[model samples]
Target chain A: MAEDCILETSGLVKEFRGFVAVNDVNLKVRRGHIHALIGPNGAGKTTCFNLLTKFLEPTRGQIRFNGIDITREAPQKIARRGIVRSFQISAVFPHLTVLENVRIALQRKLGTSFHFWKSDRGLNQLNDRAMELLTAVDLAGYADMVTVEMPYGRKRALEIATTLALDPELMLLDEPTQGMGHEDVHRVMELIKQVSANRTILMVEHNMKVVAGISDTLTVLARGSVLAEGPYAEVAANPLVIEAYMGTEASGLASIPANDDRPPGPLPGEGDDHGSLRSNSGGAG
Target chain B: MSRRVTIAYLLGLALLLAAPMFIYPILVMKVLCFALFACAFNLLLGYTGLLSFGHAVFLGGAAYVTGHALKVWELPTLVGLLAGTVAAAALGWVIGSLAIRRQGIYFAMVTLALAQMVYFLFLQAPFTGGEDGLQGVPRGTLFGLDLSVDINLYYLVLAIFAGSFWLIQRTIHSPFGQILKAIRENEPRAISLGYDVAKYKLLAFVLSAGLAGLAGATKTVVFKFATLTDAHWHTSGEVVLMTLLGGMGTVFGPVVGATVIVTLQNELADKVGSLVTVIMGAIFVICVLAFRRGIVGESLALYRRMIGQKAG
Candidate 1:
């Protein structure tokens, strides 16, 4: 592992009932860089992201974050270690106001989470900072609005703003721009760019435009393994990467490519591996 | 605060103060106890998204402990209540630690199973008096004031209920309450935000259990008995009905639910006799089918819709 790498994984594997969803994968993300993991639908990108975030335990391999071996750490522990994540579904407290959502994130730093008897007024101290974070995300105008009422693009923005309130060293975002329109995609890309200035980012995104536009480093996964890794321009042009993208439509559903069993494709497997991968990929990635 | 909520609370306070004059003090006390019990249960079900089907154990179990201490050990009234509250909290910690290992219906099942175990233990245990329960427990004086009189006990019950209600309100609005709501709204999201979801859940459970015990202890004092009725699974079901009927997530929902249900039981049990259960079942079905959000939730939604239309 390089000294500058903020996150490193070696031989990471996730298996369910003898079916390996993510095979032996070695992923290293440099500090202070936006690293995008891009792959075909069944490439195990989401699985890889879950493993890194400690949401799913790896069957084998070690994950190191900031020089700490975090393979056995819990998801919340990993989050507290400065690696916060945003869900693909725009994880905001639907009943809470946008400011309350951000304030909940900021409250962890205050170390009064267990102080149940204290008046919530003590949390008033954090309002200015929470507001600042919302303002940074262009959500200050909607501070008092309950998050469920916010527009989809704005919800994603709120998710990012909440994640940013943690002041994390690394942020893991799964499909930050999934299900977005042309304009939403553009706004999120710019927001990611802005937030990436101070912290490292590891994201699994399906949008090729987003991958190409802002990713400083790209790792291509197919069949739960890293098919290629390099800068966006280099990896995007690779024949193996081209082969992976060709069989699959740019619309993101081009079968599993499981039969090819070669470069940029899933290895030949027993029948019915494709059954849940679609749902898993959609939900996880 | 919304104008509606403030007015409702004021109305509630007035009703509470004037209730003993019109209604039987003991009946009002019973309602207050159940109301507190429902509110405590709501902290988990409404705000934390946990459904515990065995909460009656906490309330009933505390009643037994307080009755035992006050009657046998001859402890002071306040001391006996504290003992009951502590006992309930400890039980809650144990049960919550185990129950929180599961989620949704599974969590409810775990709590229900544990409560059944508690029921059997009390049934077979010597101190509980088995089928007869701890009977004719004394209602001691508070400080220097004698609490044996109906009026005095009413005030005491009112004060305790108000304090518990205010505490619940404080908790819901407090930072810890915010986290509970967040966990209820979305667990994985709260976890990713660096919250130990299990810990928050366990704490909420303990708090709920402790408060439930307070209600039970108070009930024991008013009724002068801790019986099988307190610990029965039927009691657990009744509290769930109260919360759902009032409004699962609303601030005043549980109290309203308790009032409506207790009134229904008090009035109908006399005329309809055993058919009260059938009527309650019908009410539950109607609440679930028509106003799924319960009375308070539906009213709030309606008010919001009206206000939003006017503003727009």
Candidate 2:
């Protein structure tokens, strides 16, 4: 109920049949802070994000955004309320030009979302702004190119650019740097930091360095419940947080010591450790 | 790019102006009516990615309405056409709301089932004259100009066809059309961007249905009768064939497809009547196997390739 909290969830619960995917939990994200949600595999991180975005209905609990109840709002309705989200998979309109992908998002703010009678040529006015967002993400030169032709990492950047076009007050990023190269991870991490200025971001990330490097607040969920919540350093040193992650694969966790700068290598399905690293399924926690 | 489209438009206009002097006006009018029908159907199928297998309900249902208005109610030609168009639009809104609940093939099947219901309704409806249909529909004067003559009727049909076709082209290039394409390509992404996808789909359905109704109403005036054949399920399949054969996404594709299919039907009616469906089936197969993009799509790709080669 704090005035500074932009997004607050109380007793959020989601159950799939009989199994509870996201158990009762409360989360509050302060305005203008980079908050990261991290947990091991099957930790109900995605389910929680889906519940917040209204993509999946919660079995119980309420979510308040900007002091308004948004728990019953439609996904698009919540998006209109300035809480926009990006998918874990690069979610770009593959057939549309990169410029068009961004322009469609911008069109919503201009009140032209349902203007079927007007020529799309009138939308040329938004091109300059779309280009600016694309340029910020280093995609200016590829504006006219179809999104499918863009490289993997660049597609993720395009997704960020499209999300940024919404000018969201509370951006929910689902694994911003999920599948990327080392250089791409660094570039996207920097891009996220640049965009995070003057905006509140709640991201579900697995990359330790990206989270530790940028996140002002961290919330770790294990087995459908919050295990630790605090500043990155405090949560990173939390004994329970370390055990929850280490109990999974340990390879990605073992590399990150108590006070080390070198973050763990790419998580599952990223690069070299793709097939070798499996998402830990059976979590008793 | 606009210049090229304008040139094509002007060329098409010139060809149409010269057509009635040589070919039969009635046949050409038939082609134009079917062409518009196919184009309207493409708006939903190609642009919105929602296929309605029962689209003939709009076309045939409008024909019956217009025919009844002209023969029974004795309304003016324009007024009857307007009534038919409104009726079809209302039907589209209702059917689209129900059909949009399901997706892909399920949507198509729901539409098909709805069309069958409409078909039986018309089959027994008193105003539609049952199997005999509404016969001897009067083609009244248009703004003081008489349309009883074949040449006069031809020009009026031509005007309506061109005007409706232009409206459809404008709709496709509109901001609303862009949203339809966005939803077609990636629906969840469109939703994430705060679009009410259901509303857009329903609007498109209504627009397409209104235009298809316009085509049907005009066809009644041209033919002087509204028959069971117009509302038959076979008519739905034929429009799909025309749109697919000419290219679903291209603007001129439906016209080309309708012309080809209608011409084939006319030519084969007397010589090889029974084989017409078989030959049409063969063409469909060939188009699907070899030119899946349809005629216009293939040509456009070739043109783009040639331009790319020259630039490279």
Candidate 3:
């Protein structure tokens, strides 16, 4: 069980000035599992993602990737070590063609990223693989389209395709479906599941339905610390997790079912927008 | 390359080859020098998204180096030019290492401040001839062809411009160029994709400085002098104006921008005198207000729109 952990963070901590954004998080992600880190706003989920990817260095902790200490590694080195992250906002190169965006990732492996004098005609060989990745995300039809001109949800799909181009062992997705219609969310969720085969995904997701639908394990964070960790059903039913998510006033954990696609009751601090969610899902269906 | 673009390039080349017969060769050589300078500047400002406020340091610094080598050192023309380019590249490495540590306006400020320091150093340096400028730089022979003749020098400058232009074009389309555009579009995303963003930016800075240095070195050989005007902050500002007026990121934008600005400066310098500055300023204002994409970018956008409408 100990050896099964592909990424393990022991006593991870991050501080901005005097304020501790992520406080002492000890996380262990098993190999080849779709792990979801779900939390409300300001739960330091994004900060944790930043820490893992080395965008923000940990104030105190040891990040071990396959038992090697990576806490001090640079962000690009971490990426080169096969841990790639997607931005909260769709991260495609806006002016580049969709195909070109994916090709940029594929080009990294060609060992000629510094050969400025060579013609890019050599990169044409990468087009087939770029198209394959694009097709995987159902973006083959829009290969020639400038990414800025792409539909919002499709841009997210392209982000996934670009991330896939690196063939990362651990893919960190930050709000993969943050701003999406129900149909798009459902599609992205399906796409995430499809791409998660034989690879580990550590995603920071806010949408409960998407989290519940695909994730193999759940890590609930609140106030920058782990509140609960287990299977979805178990974590969703944990009293501390429920209290943290809904405040003390909410009862009956069954209201937020593990398998239900319909919008759940409004969690604490989020305004009552359940009606809009239901209507969006209904209209999309 | 597209057939249309290739045809345009060829026709432009032919026009330049025949230009010396009709126009003053010296004036054409001036245009070519500036055109190359602007193109090199665009590689950083346009493709890499780095706005260098101190690029005049490279241009002026190289001019002084070339002038000294030719006049004082009595070095061959090619060797002098090489020395100038290498010096600029070394300076670029030093400045770029520091400037890339900051980003955006901070990056610009760092480059600007460093350039000012170099400018002051050049002012006090004994070899530069100070206020008098480095005078009477020899053209010398290049591969047994005496470059003292205007036609011979013009052809050499043309060859240098064409070769450097081809190199820039190749870089823009290379694998490295793809990454550069990615960095320009979204830097953090590029970093997260496992790129050393700072390293790429520095390399780009060095390459741009080297090419700009080449242009300045060539300019010194053509005019037979290197002056404080070459390194002035105004020259830096002028290159920016040329890039912006021609088009920031387009392949041919800087060339067109340089020609227009240099031609206006020359034609108006004798007639309107210093008012040429005011006219250039007015043109800049109009360019920014009306065509923010500059001439080439706007034309391309318009052409694309027309083609899209027809296809649709």
Candidate 4:
């Protein structure tokens, strides 16, 4: 491990049954840096994130965060260690006010145990802190509005603010700009930069422009293995990267072609459709 | 919850507390007990979005414990209440841990199956007094103050009901409750945002179970009897009916539902007796299909609409 490395994984392997989802992944994320993982579909970017976050255990290999092994820690335990994740789909609490959503996350980080008699100390401080995060994301004005009522771009911003509540040392972002309009993508990219100023970040992104715009180093994966690893410019020009990006749909479909062309399929009463639909949707790739 | 909603709730609670003067104290006691039970159940179903059809296990389990403590052990009333609550809390942890592995419909069925197991256990267990139940248990006193008089018992029941109601309102207002709501709305998103959803679900379940136990414990002492019907699946359906009719997520919704349903049962007890189950099932369907948000929820919405109109 290098002196500046904040998160590192060595020989990471994750398998389902006999099939490999993430095969022998080795990577390192430097402190106070924006590192992006860009790979084609079925490249196992999400599986790697899941394994590292302890949502799923690896078949083999170890992950170290801030020089401590976190390969086997529980998901919440890993979160308590100051690592947090952001999803492509917004993770903000929709029914709660935007401020309340972030404040709840902040309260959780402050160990807000379930109690019927406690005072509102953590709650007040958390509310203030959530406002600060929302301020950073330019969402402060919408603080009291229900998150679901907010525009989509603002909702995405709320997710980032909530993730920031964990006080993360290493932030794992899974497709931060998915399904965004150009303005939202640009805003999210700007927010990501502001967030990374105090943390180390590892992201799996499909949008090349966003990756190139902010990433200090970029790691590319193809078919569950590292294809290239370097700065965005180097990784962008790599022949292997281009091949993998273009080759993705062919190999991805071969493994589960039935799902790609199959109709919405029969209802549950049809029997065989249930088993097939379950298998198809149950994570083959 | 909105500010106007809170104001409306306080108004409703005031009316409910005053209702015993008009209605029979026994009727008020029954409603309060059932209301507490439903409110506790709502902590899980409403906030965490996990439905437990086996809550009778907690309700009935506490009834048995409190009944046994009062009858066999001759314990103080408060001691019986605490014993019942602790027993139910422990049971909730065990059942919740296993049931939480599955989600949605599976979770419901798992709870239902587990409740049936508890039902049979009560049916066979000696301490539960089998079919006859533990009869003639004493309400005794609040620290030996002789709560035997109906008026005294009414106040005691009122205090317990109010305390439970306040505790639930406070719990939902807490940050932990906010997190539970988040998990209910979007569990995978909550997990990605670093919450251990299973832990949240279990915590909500345990809290709901404990309060429900409190309700059951008080009920046993109130009526001075614990019967097989207390632990029956009908009771489980009864609580669900109350929650649905009251408002699944709103604080006062379950209380209102409980009061109305209990009153309906009291009215029908002499007329159609055995048909209570059929009527409750029908209400459940009607509530789910036609009036999902419930009476209090609907009332709150109307309040909001009025407020909006005033602001405009």
What's each prediction's clash count? 0, 0, 0, 0
TM-score of each: 0.93, 0.93, 0.94, 0.88
RMSD of each: 6.0, 3.1, 3.9, 8.3
lDDT for model 4 comes to 0.80
* lDDT to native, each model: 0.87, 0.87, 0.89, 0.80
Model 2's alpha-carbon lDDT is 0.87
Ranking of all candidate structures by their DockQ, best first = 3, 2, 1, 4
Error of 1 at A89 (Å): 1.1
Error of 4 at A24 (Å): 1.8
Q: Write candidate 1's Cα lDDT for A215-272 as tens digits.
A: 8898989888898998866675678776766633422323332221222212233122
Ranking by lDDT: 3, 1, 2, 4
In lDDT terms, which candidate is top? 3
Better of 2 and 4 by DockQ: 2
Per-residue alpha-carbon lDDT of candidate 3 for residues B36-119, written as tens digits (9 for 90 to 100): 999999999999999999999899999999999999899999999999999999999999999999999999999999999999
Name the runs in model 3 displaced over 4 angstroms.
A1-3, A247-254, A259-285
The residue-by-residue lDDT of candidate 4 on A1-285, one tens digit each, is 346888889999998999998999999888998999867568888888888888898999989987888888888788778888876676777788888878767766567755545544447866777788999989999998988899888888888888888778889988887767766777788788877888999998765556656788888887789888987556655676655544433232122312212333232222221111111122422
Q: For candidate 2, lDDT tens digit of each residue in B1-312?
A: 166776897799889988999999999999999999999999999888989899999999999999889888999999999989999999999888999889999999999999899999999989889999889999998888888888888888888988888888777878888899999998888988899898999999999999999999999999999988888889999999999999988888999999999999999989997999999999999999999889998999999999999999
Candidate 4 residues lying further than 4 Å off, grouped into runs, are A1-3, A119-122, A247-285, B1-17, B143-145, B188-199, B309-312
